[model samples]
Target: MSSADSSSSGFVLLGVEDVEDCALSNEGEGSLPLDRFGYVSDLVKKGNHAFRQSRLDMFEQAINYYTRANQIKPNDPIILGNRCATYLRISQFLKLRDSSDSEDRPLSGLDPTIHAELALKDAEKLGEIQSNTVRPFILKASALLLLEKYELARSTVISGLQVDPFSNSLQGALQHLEKMQAGNNGRRSHTKPERTDDFDCTLCLKLLYEPITTPCGHSFCRSCLFQSMDRGNKCPLCRTVLFISPRMSAVSVTLNSIIQKNFPEEYAERKAEHDGLTNFGADLMPLFVMDVVIPCQKYHLHIFEPRYRLMVRRIMEGSRRMGMVGIDPTTGSFAEFACEVEITECEPLPDGRFLIEVEGRRRFRIIRSRDQDGYRVAEVEWVRDLQLPDGSQERVDLLESTNNIAKHASSWLTRARQASQQDRSRYEKLLGLERMMPTPRDPERFSFWLATLTNRTPREKLDLLQLTNTRERISRALIYMRSGELGCRLDLNTITNAPPYTI
Candidate 1:
């Protein structure tokens, strides 16, 4: 017998649509091989059931069904991918429960780390299969992210995007990287400088932090001097030619003693970390001296505003730390997430305004912001990193769908490239068309596909920000790509109204 005929006896072929309603009416009635039809039908029904259960938040039941489906079709990529997604959901639920437990209470026997590791392994294995390979890559990236290997996770995502530029999951990964990088850079630039009361620099508005005493007995922040030198080598206060070395004078013994006495906790923490006295603690600390009152995300942001600027200046002058809070997009108000900043660079503008850079090292959530000593003071709570959901089959399906879209998109790109080579002027007329052409593992192209494919409406594009899961994002993008409504427009109006700029 032929291979197809031989295989027919071992497995069932069920219509994808019929499995959704859980009707097994055709199980024994058909002339086809009993084992094959029964198995495939049963597997499909289980998948449908799992999907329904997941939507209802009956995650445990969903996981069981997904597990069974995988057993029936052990090598099936879609089934494997879906199972991984279910596993991820279970992990998330367990972690949430653990977080709610009281510190005084004894821990449960279950270990979240073990579960996460197992799920990650399964994801990696499933990623190896040719039919469902992309699923593994996406899941592996997510697993790496949960494990706190940010750089590795970012690289994995970039690699996946290279294979499938239209993947929403890869796009999400790229965005996550950008946000993390931004937060890291922001934190490094915002370190607070030392304070001196002998001479107050008019530029930064306090007794000079990182005081560089000039020949004329004036002192300014080191950063302020460097910036001033770029325009004119004159002091803002006296317009004297300010000549100074790069190094700042050492912290006076008396001021250091006073800080050690007044802020014992802060002083000790800084000293231990800086002196390498503590092997386990982080190297840097947050900006402000505020007590934490709530839990927040990994990082907090402080926008450049007027009142907060003065608050930062005062904190740098004495404590060398200042509080930060993220602004809500809806109300333009502060969120619970906050951090402490250290002013590293404080520059004086010719107009007496200060240009400063601060670094954020730790995260906190704000309980309240109160006005103190003409500056805003926040009560915050320190937060630790939260665990992500485990691997799931839905995640696998999303990855598979993304790969399907990528295959189609790449084919389109190939065609476009061929067309471009044939007629350059014709290609030029199609604005946004060139973007569809493939690049050498470009992150920008991945982002472009994500925006073009999944976001049918402006509102939908805005909603993409809310989805945390990479797989879900990719699935949404696939739906858009199949709709056949993308990359069809070239806004000639903008092209016609352009300035004299030419390519």
Candidate 2:
């Protein structure tokens, strides 16, 4: 089998799409009795053949062949590497596949997450067997990236670089990690010094934004250094090979502060330029693509990724708002509808993560979307329920429906609280729901508030966000509340993943 770079440039698989060549000989296996080694070779050849096909089912077949080969030659680097690559490839395919398709014809065996976890195991074993080769580091790092363990992925790449300083793949992976930290926005500088070319980045010749001072005692804009490294893994000015990765290279705080204090006007201009990229316009907002949130929903989020950290910092400086969205599996993109949320509280942790409380305010439909730096940005149109005429029959009916649901919800809460007294988590959920109860006078907000009392899938919540009829929305909420009450009688875990109820 020929080993080359795969999609992420880390796996030691054959070709990107197909098997171009195979070296394992099966000449005598058909005609003669084969030994253990001969049989192992034959299995690997078959695995390679299947892997080269690049179809979802074929990838699974390749994994099966590799698994059999591994049984014959346990911990073999070749077998382990090939299998790891295959697992990652299949997981990627499944993740991008339409959700409806998977639901319609579900895989009978392992899911995407399981496949990625299995790949990580194989990568770890391969690393132990081939400690001196760059391939092990590549495979392990690739698996970690697929698993969304950003810090671990960076560490793996940094370690791989220690083994092979000139490895392009490792360097590329490190650069990718840095971009994940945030966009091109740089830190503010302080100090009093005569402004000159010294504050300028050699690459952009502009005032330094997020400046980094390399070990070689050279300073350059963080984005400039990484962009230069993209073409060649070396210092732009010097021929020195830099060892600094995202974890290792941090912005020069003192220098950054000096620049900010000395040139206030220029700094403000630069800030505006950067903000223009992250925050598009009055109707445009930066998007956090993770979960489905609805108006009146309040929750806490752990923001660790660099890009989001940067996005949060920018929001804190301005309107303190952003959009929360979930990917639509059918389109493999942002769902059409999302909720705008305001950051009610933001506590920046010592480790650069944010513990923030956000409350959903308004629902919006994405008119268009685009990639801004490493995250997503979009222009959206706000959504609101169509109001019923005052004193009309429909309005009166909605009020009656709301009151009935509210009474039912209250009775359910009382029982749930009594049952959950022995279970702190469930009790806490009930308490949260009680605190979020809205008066029946506002049937529209009341409907969304009612839905938060139960745990529903993102798809289900997205459906709620798209509803413009208060009565219909309240009816659906009543159904879910009733269902949860039933589920709780048998098992308490059916309550929202947390204490139940928050849109």
Candidate 3:
């Protein structure tokens, strides 16, 4: 209810522990509707006072009280805002209190900026995005500035200026941030690079971002730990029972400080990882270009190639995901368009080969490529259909065209089935088409599914897969069907004789 209570679960009713963790009255009771909205508001006011008390202990007390008020009226903007503010203060307090550890140097995965970012996120949830609000922008810029994301911070400030051009507070904050960035950039220093692998979280197996250290002293990415916490409140490494809520728990400040002090390079990577945007796909993945595949569809693969075998093992170890592409006949490279696929089923053989099944998740446009362990991998941006808004003229027209084309497509597939009824090889493909034909509601997905089931040459498959726009893809398929090109391509021999692929 606290707009950004990261621990908040969706749809699942809270158990007594969750409810108790959220809402407790002064008398240590469940509170259970006994606290009026007005009383909850007063608690928020007290929490704000506690935050301003200039005491670290008081700052945590502020978060506790604010959190309780939030449990009562989850949507109360004031309480949510104050709670986020309290978290930020608590973060600062912890940093100051343990600034210099004489001992092993406190290592933590705690991310303080998350509090500021979540503050703005919650503010936006209260319809603050449309309002001429200075607080949200300040909080947003604060988080970005802390992460050394000056460009984004400047842009966020500019957006705030657009809302309230005359706010001196915002204008002053912007100037101060710019000066700080200039000073930091101008500062010169040379140092030995630090190893990122040392701080890598075992879960994602990626460099840690917003790291957390549990009671058992195992550190992990905050998000990764939360995912595991969702299944059970225990550390994935040592089976140590966690005594804290993932959402309410802050990243370990001591561990982070230690990492920052000892390994500045790794610290930078951690910040960069947190700031990373997965535009069209999951981070980046290996491109499986042996064949063509479509989003929302699944494929069975036999991994015999050493490179692919390595790719599969890496995928399983990391995200269990990869991008599926086809060799471009024109350019002799991986096709520009590709589908992001996730390994759903993996079975290892006595030999080194693996029999695996993958389901496509998203479409992406490859931005850059590199060879890793004898396989092709790339960074990609997520690509989606050029969808028109609901009830709009273009939207209506596209749907109309899609529905009409679906009818035509249905008829063609039906005819192919009837004609090939005697031919088991061809009919096998057509028999499955009619029963599982995706509706035209998602023209892009429907078109891709249609293309996948068709026994077309790899060249034709790439052509369909390359079309990104939903309406354009649908139109192109419609043209293929109308011109009888699809009919010719759906031949039994053509289906059986095409190159057998593993990906």
Candidate 4:
């Protein structure tokens, strides 16, 4: 209630001081002391006095006193109701305060929305404590109205009407809610303005999606802004240096809402367009140009570049999968063969970097590739080793070779573990690779797993990916394993100043 309404019937404050004192005196006759009643009454009276004063700070002081009184007399309906009203009054005052008049004198405290929310909480508690009273509903309706929840306010008023059919306060609140709804409907019914560039992002020349306004007063789509920032830390239009990153930036909520409410169809199309790039399709995949990863191999990646950071966010939102590839030393472009990896864990840091764990799933050949935003996207065809005919002599021979390779791999790991005692990193890698050993029955998978036993250059790994014959790949891995075993033995023999051991 406003100070102007203090003399009118619209303003009301219940006087419960005498009733509280009388009840406390009755309790005193049982076990309570008279001094306790005096202290509680003093607090309630102080709250009422401060609430009546025409100042914002006085409202806070009133809430403070009411809170103290409530602590002494828990669940007091009178205290809760008064505090709810005070919260509502202070919130309304802050929202309606004249900005021009306060240019020289700034007000500092809780924002209007927070105060309204607090009032709503207290009003809800009061309703539970005194369900049969009309006052709780009235307080609740008023708070909801202040918070711009007109439908809930109307429902609260109707519930109050059911309790007291002739309540003037509830009838007035219900009418106010109806009028607000009609006004909103009428405004929305008006003819929309012609399409213009005002709602379009300058960077992409399209309707803005998740629009972000730079400090220099220019707006662009969030992805477009950061993608351009990848080239330089400056605004595209103004060329002004911007120290802001996507992690530190926020969307322009008001502008985005306005565009959504005004041109919903265009906004939806813009969202679909953005989603298409992020969640491209089943046959298409985004490529992370990094290293040669084969199936069953797992590793972690630290993403810090602006483009990859943006890519990681999109991947996490969609399939959590991407193609990991290496640059071809011959063509200076992405290798023709790449492996698909799925992100198992992604942790986004406060500084906008991502620490992600990805595991290689299968291989794919890039049929065609292009750039989207700042990263590579490709139309790929899944690659698998050509299988030998079932029950054929070639298949039988392949199985025998795979089993022999597996035995050799086991013996090599045991010897490497004994030799790598002083090298903690190498020992840990060996142990991890050992745990992931595949079965010899699936020769294709076993070949890839076996290739991991020895460190190969990117070119050698790329050659492994290009091979389609399982027996040839298995033989290639056996060569690497034997060479690695021989190198370990040679190192030991040299360290001991003895003859080299045979593998």
Q: What is the C-alpha lDDT of each candidate?
A: 0.44, 0.70, 0.59, 0.72
Over 1-503, each residue of candidate 1 has an lDDT whose tens digit, in order, gives: 11111111121111111112433333332222354336545655666566555432444454455544443334455555555555544443343343324233322222233334445656776767642335566766655554445677678777777788887656756775677667656655333345344344567554343345555656565445534544554566688654322211222223343445554665565555433311212322222333221111112234334344444434433444555444545556654555555553343222223455454434455666666433455556655432233356644544455555566666754565456655644433222233233342322223234444322543343333333454444445444554444455333233343221110
Model 3, range 1-503, lDDT digits (tens) per residue?
Answer: 12221122111101001111233233433232232444565677777677777565576577667655554455454565555555544444333333344123332323333344444455455335235666566555544543335677788778878888986656765676576557656652445345657678899887767678776788898767755664565689999765443434456654555567677776687666544322223557687877777765667799877667656655654567888888888889778888888875554442345677787777788899988657877988887767678999888877777777677667777667678857855654454355446778877788776555444566766666666577656544544454365244343323333222110
Error of 3 at 325 (Å): 2.2
How do all the candidates rank in terms of TM-score, highest first? 4, 2, 3, 1
> What local lDDT does model 4 show for residue 202?
90
Best by TM-score: 4
- Model 3 CA lDDT for position 130: 30
3 or 4, greater by lDDT? 4
Better of 2 and 3 by TM-score: 2
Tens-digit lDDT string for candidate 2 (1-503): 23233344222322123332344333432221244457567778888989988787788688777866664455667778888888777766654554355334543223344456667777888788788988778777766765556678889889988999988777776776776544323542233689899998888888988788875677887656644553444678886765433213446756776888788898888777766754557899889988999887877899877678667766765678999999887788789999999886554442345677788888999999888656788899989999889999988877886787688788877777787767855655565566567888889999899888877778788989999988767767766776665664323335435333322
**Model 2 worst lDDT window (10 residues):** 9-18
Candidate 2 wrong stretches, greater than 4 Å: 1-195, 201-205, 208-265, 277-280, 345-350, 488-503
Candidate 1, number of clashes: 40
Identify the runs in model 1 with alpha carbons over 4 angstroms from their true place.
Answer: 1-37, 55-57, 96-98, 101-107, 131-133, 185-503
What TM value does model 4 have? 0.52
> Cα RMSD (Å) per model?
26.2, 20.2, 17.1, 18.8
Model 4 residue pairs with clashes? none
